[model samples]
Target: MTGLSAAAGLGRTSALAVACARDLARHAAEHPGLFPARPFDAGFFHSLGLVGAFGSPWATAGELRAVNRAALWVFAVDLQVDHVAKSREEVAALVGDCLAVAAGDAPRGPLTQCLASLRDDLGADPRWRDQLERMLAAMLKEWDWRESGATPGLEEYLRNADSCGSAFVNLSHWLATGDQWTLANLDLVRAADDEVQRYLRLLNDLTTYDREARWGDANALTLGAGRAEVTERMARHARTAAELIDPLRETSPRTALYLERQVGFNTGFYGVSDYWGEL
Candidate 1:
């Protein structure tokens, strides 16, 4: 896809993420006992707070709320995929259902409808639709790996993170500047640039931490043979993500600085660490 088309595709995916997050949060709230003990539901809600505290200034409160919901969806899907491998047939069916819906077929249930809406919204661009289909295919392949009892390769994990992160970045940009680039007001662009950078940093950290945790799990699952290799690969992926974000950070130096301060203050007051202490 062309750069503009690619960007638009990302934005659409971000929108889907937002929608997914919302639905997941609602589901978890309504079915609290179904989740694991580590506050998965609560964590998803907390991630939304992180997004709001670090999101762009030009975005409407409604839009930010949407972003929060989307983030939750992304988290929910990842966790589901991670654990659902235990029941490959069931998970595969869900994955297939998602793919069918994404392909323009009507879903069979309310939950499926929500998933379909998210996918359809994200697939606004024909190219994006194709990309989403490819992503689904990859997800199926990953599921197959799980079914075969193969560890997920570091590259596979990183590719998923990049795709998800790009979607968030695009959504944040769109919220900040709307659809008109040259016509975008300076204040809006500045706000968007700053917010987007902060988000990238947050997501980068989240991805790194998650991968590290996953590697630990992989080590446990594989009886320690894969730990060193997985760690090295995850580290490389983290570095690659950092490199990709540098230019984006450079695009709004002043905004980045302001965002750093904002994040610092916010974290001090209401971050996960702070909550941990309180608990």
Candidate 2:
């Protein structure tokens, strides 16, 4: 009962959606090649439904924008690294630009600019800078794997996938909710990764396997898994996630509720959308 309504969360932030639309529209007009029309366009961004996924009942308008902006930046990095950039050098350079900006240099491109904007707007916390580094390193691992044309072991794939920055963004919601928690201690993130995030990564593969294969990228399913095997793996993770959720219920019920809400949001979001698929 303590969980916030995902739909209601978006509803309360209707103005954020409008602002995003206008801002993206203007950026597309101004940036041309950099902000290209496909992914950065209003229609596609609206289809992402990020407002609901990242929106928290307890966040102020400014806090909501900060977390939501951070979440979008994470996805942009994934798209550029996963589907766009062809060479390892290209990926490495982009990562370097972002890290440099996070480290206080001026940004060089759209991706780095996005990182700089968020870090500046959010107070340039070194923890946020660390997350930028963490996400880029994990994303670079995929390029290394693809460049080698080797199949990653299940353990290895899941480990890198968790580094997708979902957990970091999830943790950021603490700050969004009146600084209830901070990203100061990353040690405890293992608890979130243990179940809630395990379920998310597995489900992401289950839903995006075909699309990922088309792009020649790694997914949880790309490791010799058929649809049945992938679905089964998701189910197993769900059970483990449930077990982890129980302890949270008694201790930090609020954090537990947030996890539960995220699991539900991811389930419904990926269930209906084929945005990542090729066909």
Candidate 3:
């Protein structure tokens, strides 16, 4: 594969990662009071679904395993943000764990194996690696303040948050520029379109209670509206991404399969109904 093709693959994975992070943030914002008390136990498999969506099954099982593990650590931080009020030490531990896994210094597992395969396929493609490293660095820096039981300044926090989105943007950029990659083959644009629609429907259903309950009006009015906006943006990004990936899909069956599976997993696992059935 050409450098561009390798980058496209990485971009697809990055897009999914951004989606996962967005969902994580949404969950946190929506139920800030509940997460800290309940300690989000959505189960390993549920979290794995997000990883599977971003990373391909063609990746060694080890890579997938690592991805899942790292996800746990990442989500755990979000879940604990309001609950435990983590001490600096606690926050440091979490950040350290995330970095270790992201850097490939952690033990090899199914997730790691998968990542290795992806890296190998992307041979000499520094863009993806550089982006990944940059994101990791930002995350680590953010954690430094989180460890102190104090939030990072708004600018820093937003920058760190942008890293999550940038992960996908980098992927989209690669797809747009790469020679061997094309939107026709990847169908990325199409998949992203589907995801945006699904996200809107899911958000609407999930927040219906807030729309009706006596005290929920505020939440419904604010969060509900905000979610719609966020989903809309995500939809736009997905289209941009799809335009980049669709053409490459035909050339990369393994990568294509991975993206398809990811969408299914995201829908099935994180679908608002799955978690808020009673609501």
Candidate 4:
């Protein structure tokens, strides 16, 4: 991540993102039969402050586009996992095609195309390739659990959450901006950043608990924890994330702030959406 100075606002970056969002909208429109009804238009990425977030050290227009494309691509695949896959067999087939595309197999569908584009943009980075593979695997594990009606423990859920594409998307920006330091030290970066992912998981669990209950999907808060207990757990992760960010600041302030911004993004969206049941 590169363009972060303390003073810059997200306006210019958001303009770029607005254009990207429109492009995604058009893509979804064009691929009517292939993607979700709302795909990528849900303001998920937009609300992330994508334009200015993530140390955006973009040096060229093409570079920025590449990053944006990869960002869109990841979200597009996630939308598939969340809304489309209906069974273990279906998920296996979907993951197989996407994995093949990511591994240089022929692109088979819109989602696979997105994976292919991201793979091309990444250009032989085995670390990110490994990361993406792990993310997809984690998604499958969660889906399998959901399908089997098995509620996971907090630790099990957290383990899967770390690789459930949330953290992978954030860390992908490091590669997008060609940050050598981040690429070289991803494990360390993820270690310091783990609590941020946990925060996201809990907040997502809280916000979507009702929806998941209605859908009969797996959720952390519903897995043997009362609302009060879940709320307290969310607080613990948030506080721990703040402490984690302090050490991260010493290593890379932009990345540190980026993590905090995600927390901000999640909380603000949660408030507005009444994901906490305040409404």
Candidate 5:
């Protein structure tokens, strides 16, 4: 592409990111408890928006709504499970409430209310609930490990990577804006997303080990995996993710590109900064 075209593309992405940030701030304002100011500050909204806008630059702010909201919801859930909940019962209650909302029950609180809004917005996709449950279960498992001071094996920690929430965000994106081919081939795409999610999980662990340690959160490094080990695992998963994504280009090119951008964007973005604000 010419330099002018490249500059135009950048301009479009910046504009989309700004629009997404506006929408996200509105949502956060509606559910203040779920997005407290300390962590979910202005930078968080801006960064989350950029993730969506850049991950699928072809998409508009409206088209990116589900993914953006889904990503925000993941952070809210993480904050509750990792920081707010004082006891196992409290965490379990939060999980139950969220699942109930997903299952069509009335939302009982800010977290569930936000989840319910997302569910209704995504229309009818059973996979949304399935992916959501996987994320929630992974989070609960991590909470249990933390509470019991359990150090799960690296493989096991990697297996429970739904707690990273990327796959859930991907599913929401696909459900909201994917073409027919992409929708039909979701299982194959999800396999690719799962691989990417694991890579992202390790990527997060690599950068956030100090914060994780300070926050008493579970991480691969905290579980005794060396940085070399984690980096090696990230490389392996990234390769597998590519292999899984390769077949989709012919049938679901946008879906393929979306996944590719996720890996590419985070590889660079996480190297410099993360999406969260100070604690």
Candidate 6:
């Protein structure tokens, strides 16, 4: 593409990102308590909107809603679990409430209400609830590890990767706008997502180690893994993710590119910035 066309393409994606950001801001307003001003600021919303817009540039804002909403929901849950909840019981209660809403119960609070809205938008994907359960469980387990002052090895820490929430967001995206082959081969797609999730987990840890250390959140480096080791492991996962994604190109080309772009985008984004604003 020439410079002019390249600039035009970016302009279109940026416009889509603006729409996605507006929608996220409206959702945040609906559940004000869930997104405190310190961190869930305007820039954070736009950054997430860009993730959805550029990750799948072919998608319209409406088509991208599930991914954007789900990504926002992850941040809300992360803040609540990592910062707000004072006790394990509180965390467990939050988890139970979300799972209950996922199972069709009435949402008892803003968090679950937000989740209920996402669920309604998602319709029924057979694996959606299962992925939710995995993410929530991983989050609760990490909370326990942090509270107990436990130091898990790199492998173990990566196993708790669902706490990062990438897979859930990807699943929501696929359910919302996936082509038939992508939908039909979800098991395989999920396998690829899981690998990417692990990569993102470490990527996040590497980028936000200082903030995480200050906040007392679990991070591989703080847990005793060396940066060199973490970097090596990330490269390994990236290779595995690429390998898993490569085969899908023949049948689910867009899905393959989506996964590939995730690895590429975050690699660059995390090199200089993060999604959170302050706090």
lDDT of each: 0.46, 0.64, 0.42, 0.64, 0.92, 0.92
Off by over 4 Å in 6: none
For each of the candidates, give the backbone clash count: 6, 0, 39, 4, 0, 0
Rank by lDDT (best first): 6, 5, 4, 2, 1, 3
Q: How big is the positional error of residue 62 in model 4, measured in Å on the Cα after superposition? A: 6.0
**What is the C-alpha lDDT profile of model 1 across 60-178, one tens digit per residue?**
44555434544544444545555534676766776677667767789875445655555554544343344445445555555565457776544444344323333443343244334
CA lDDT for candidate 1: 0.46
TM-score of 2: 0.79
Q: In candidate 4, what are the lDDT values of residues 59-176, reduced to their tens digit?
A: 3334455545555565566556766776678878887887777678888876776677667877846766777778888888877776677877787887787443666666666677
lDDT digits (tens) for residues 73-130 of candidate 2: 6766777887678789889988888888878899887777777777776676676667
RMSD of each: 10.8, 3.9, 12.3, 4.8, 0.8, 0.8
Lowest-sum lDDT 10-residue window in model 6: 121-130
Lowest-scoring 10 consecutive residues by lDDT in candidate 1?
270-279
Which predicted model would earn the best lDDT? Answer: 6
lDDT of 6 at 155: 91
lDDT: the better of candidates 3 and 6: 6
For model 1 the local lDDT of residue 91 reads 68
Total backbone collisions, model 3: 39
Which stretches of candidate 2 lie above 4 Å from their native place?
1-32, 41-43, 47-55, 58-60, 176-178, 181-186, 242-253, 274-279
lDDT of 6 by residue, 119-199 (tens): 998884558998999999999999999988899999999999999999999999999999999888899998998899999
Instruction: State the TM-score for model 6.
Output: 0.98
Model 1 ranges with Cα > 4 A deviation: 1-39, 84-86, 119-123, 151-279
TM-scores, one per candidate:
0.52, 0.79, 0.42, 0.80, 0.98, 0.98
